[model samples]
Target: MPQSRHLATELPGPRSRALMARKTSAVAGGVGTTVPVFAARAGGGIVEDVDGNRFVDLGSGIAVTTVGASNPAVVAAVQEQVAAFTHTCFMVTPYEPYVAVAEKLNEVTPGDHAKKTALFNSGAEAVENAVKIARHATGRDAVVVFDHAYHGRTNLTMAMTAKAMPYKSGFGPFAGEVYRAPMSYPFRDPEGMTGEQAAARAIAVIEAQVGADQVACVVIEPVQGEGGFIEPAPGFLPALAAWCRQSGALFVADEVQTGVARTGDWFACDREGVVPDLVVVAKGVAGGMPLSAVTGRAELVDAVHTGGLGGTYGGNPVACAAALAALDSVERDGLLQRARAVEALVTGRLHALAARDSRVGDVRGRGAMLAVELVGADGLTPDPALAAAVAGAAKAQGVIVLTCGTHGNVLRFLPPLTISDELLHDAFDVLDAAFAATSTTTASAR
Candidate 1:
């Protein structure tokens, strides 16, 4: 088998089109999709569709499969655990695998200080729980988040999130006391502004609008994921963390998309030396299984009474077993180094592409998590249509890509670490062709 993408027919082939028709009738309209093909099976870096078309999986299911979709170790662990037992509800009957996963999270997450872990079912749930812990511990109410920050979709998380359409539209009357502040987006910020300066701007907003002393926690993604893969300027994180400490607000790092070696480090916060007091992690943790965790300082997390945080399937045995195996694979496979290599390779191609094309406004992100922001002729105005067109063209060529950003003008990549270099180069070749074609088509249409 060729290890890369191979298109057997046009995208959304006969089988996929029929499935789509069924989906339109059965699935809720609120739940949308990308690529428009039905995945039959996936492994390593290829997602094979029902029609037998294979796609170079650059999105990694929104950065959930860092250890690969069908990681052998994860599959084996899950199978063994499932054969033994599926779920007993840890809260009802404590389990060994659940405890083991907590121990692993406490040890691997940043901070040498004594820490504890609580498992959850999704990033949004974990984030909401993290806030509950912080507010309970500090005896405060306000939660601070940054502009372009994507925490999650639950009511509380939606309140923390910045975007309006799709995520927040028609979902009003959100949870209260969640405030937004400016982020140190290097690309969009004033060119001369340093990260320190940016942090000061945000701090001023918090102090004035929200009153820092009243805040319970300031949650942030070390590298903003859905909001365009924006990596904040170097000093920004450290400064915010410092302010949180000084103001008695727990600094929470939402590591859902950037954790578990996806960003060339165990967690992106480690790269900035910013040790968050409370860390919420999901996405890439269980190699494709659903699992999330809130691990942080022992004192803060323990402040809440026993049984304060839990869910029916927070840490199912099979999921925990998969997580343990996935964490092992990260260390054993040297995925951290692999992600860095991906960053170097992909960014090199993107930079060259940006140099040749004025619409390629910026190339940003860290490790395997990267993005290319599309723009108009002015090189500053967002060009979402162009981004959509490029992604569509790439999908037509059997390379699955994704787009994000507040304006939806950024093309993001999250290829599994196990993807071969050959596939990476080939995927870029398709992207280059897609960009050129889309730009020409857009120009001709105009």
Candidate 2:
């Protein structure tokens, strides 16, 4: 009966603890420990835990539910699709929703040139398939990826990913011909190189080590999501696209985290006016229904043999229906503009905080995909311990925030684009309080 968000107890109250114990017995051994909260239902910006505690959702189910939890149109579409039929598996018999979603992707994704699309079940699958398309088109085997990037968990994508902890520690003998190159992390790069200089250096490495002739594709996240919400320096992406053009290598933009209006633009690559040969989209595409796509240059995409692409569950009818609804919501509600509004709000607040605390070394990101990188007073040394403590303390205060990056010292914000302005401000207030509570001294005092 409550309309306002409320936390009746510390998160993961007693009832949630009991449920988690039961879940552990049935779940996998590798599952991360639950946050101890059992959700009864969620709608629009709020999630109600089983213990009657209401919390504003900032993570958006890891950036999937951008239309907000249980969006009306999405729910309606899902319900209608379920009643009609759940799975026909595009590979099995095919359906209208699958093709319709593909048509929409081709229409919306950047590039006036002809394009084609293939549906998949997750971002990783879309990425892996994109690589396949590039390889088939170029008859090359080598692929180049940036350091600190997180593509997906599948064996091939795992090899593509740069992090080592949970994603690739014991998973050995990963897919071959995947090479790692330094990303444009201006915040951490040696000798404060300009964005153009950084791009040249990375391009040089790719040309020298991999011999672009042997490379099928060069994959990158326009705004590195898991690697830290690091936006490529100006001229970086366009330069890479130009080099890819010159070298005859496919340029793939992994927009798993930056697509679907999550960033202020429809796609971060578009913001720079750079059109990728292949774009991998998912996570927020279907409003949390598990749909992904590789919208690519038509010639490269069509290069694959008839049976070379597709999966049994790649374009499930339900997920297709959900994707239509999600896209509609983004357009009808003007969520792209809403995302920019959130960026202004978050960046303004984070900048103010950074000015007072040297620990807050940087505030960088585009649209609503914002993050704060914590560092020591020197602004050169990462302070993962403080970042963790702040995140843990924020959770204790009933605000849900997430930490990411190779160093694990970046706190990224991925609030739903549909989140209300009031809720957005309230979340900032909670962050301000968390900052205050966690601070021992100001930059000047130290």
Candidate 3:
């Protein structure tokens, strides 16, 4: 088996703390708190901190390195592209890498209909552009999104987003004509609403309140990412897609966190065979480079006049090259299928943990994009304090984990699909130990 973490000293040793201070001094004012350990380098499933502590990387840079950090093919392709030439700016002088990536996206994204793709620099830009295309195509003003959805952080996306604490708090006076609806949250929905019933209720609200005729698009994350990895019930997404088609509303699937094989399919929209008019992709697109895109129906994409969509570094050559190689690597290596295998590994461990601990309210997600939601003994109330403690304890044990959700009580795991089975299992073992230890501490405190 690969070597497990070797912790020679405490995390954030003297050297790491000094670096953190330098970062705080030099970096922007609003940058968030640095995590427990400062990474020196990462590969496969492990990140080495400056203090020589090896940590099992379960976060995968917030789901950006699905094909793995510094993948050989991605590194080689980027190096080759840099050696020849870097950016000519896709707007001024377009390059093949950008076109090639767009072509691949057109062919690979869920829709089989005639499709077009435009690249951008971040998930928020892709989402904003998707909305622009939808509004242009429908000539409508309103866009409807679900409660608990996380589109992005830009002003327009912030308006579309449903969570208010961090992504929307104090950041608003947001864009107008954005509406919110309920999600098919199986865990929390009313006593008897089936998945289909939940979807129907939401549609009713849209038709009666928002007026389908005035809505330009309906956007969703097939599996709610930041809202705690809540997978929509079986029939919800397809039914919504059908409703959008009948209402002349464009369906935009925000696959920024759930796309690129992280969820057992090239896109979650494909898993349900519910092709959206637009699909926003980023995070894992460039194998860690800053790149994003909107892929959708050709007519909808072309509806925007030429030069209406694009940015200065939308499809930078280096990132484009990395994306092409990453996509190829994902396909050739069967990372999509590998994602399911990783999911099984995670669920097997996490569900077992849930079985014993009442604090673990749920283990839910598809493929590698999984999370374990924490709750108090009542099994309904969110347990944010326990979740934070669990994450901090895991970090002390030389493992990286992330917490997210509307209530901030979900421990999300986004290990790279390229992580070895042994490494994944090792991380789970560490998690199991951490949970056991934390449970003991909780018992003692009580």
TM of each candidate vs. truth:
0.98, 0.97, 0.96
The 10-residue segment with the lowest total lDDT in model 2 = 1-10
The candidate that wins on lDDT is 1
Q: Going through the candidates in order, what is the number of backbone clashes in each? A: 0, 1, 0
After superposing candidate 3, which stretches have Cα over 4 Å from the reference? 1-3, 440-446
Question: Which one is best on TM-score?
Answer: 1
lDDT of each: 0.93, 0.88, 0.88
**Stretches of model 1 off by over 4 angstroms after superposition:** 441-446
Judging by TM-score, tell me the better candidate of 2 and 3.
2
Clashes by residue pair, model 3: none
Task: Give the worst 10-residue stretch by lDDT in candidate 1.
Answer: 437-446
**What order do you get sorting by lDDT, best first?**
1, 3, 2
Q: List the residue pairs that clash in candidate 2.
A: 12-36
Candidate 3's TM-score: 0.96
Give lDDT: candidate 1, residue 234: 88
Candidate 3 local lDDT, 1-446, one digit each (tens)? 13467787877787788988888899996667527567788777778888888888888899999998888899999999999888889999988999999999999998679999999999999999999999999999999999888988899999988788878889879999999999998877777777788899899999988998999999999999888888888889989999999999999999999999999999988877888889999999999999999999998899899899999999999999999999998899999999999999899888888777778877899889999988886778998888888888888888889999899999999999989888788788888887887784232111
Q: Candidate 2: which stretches are off by over 4 Å?
A: 1-3, 190-192
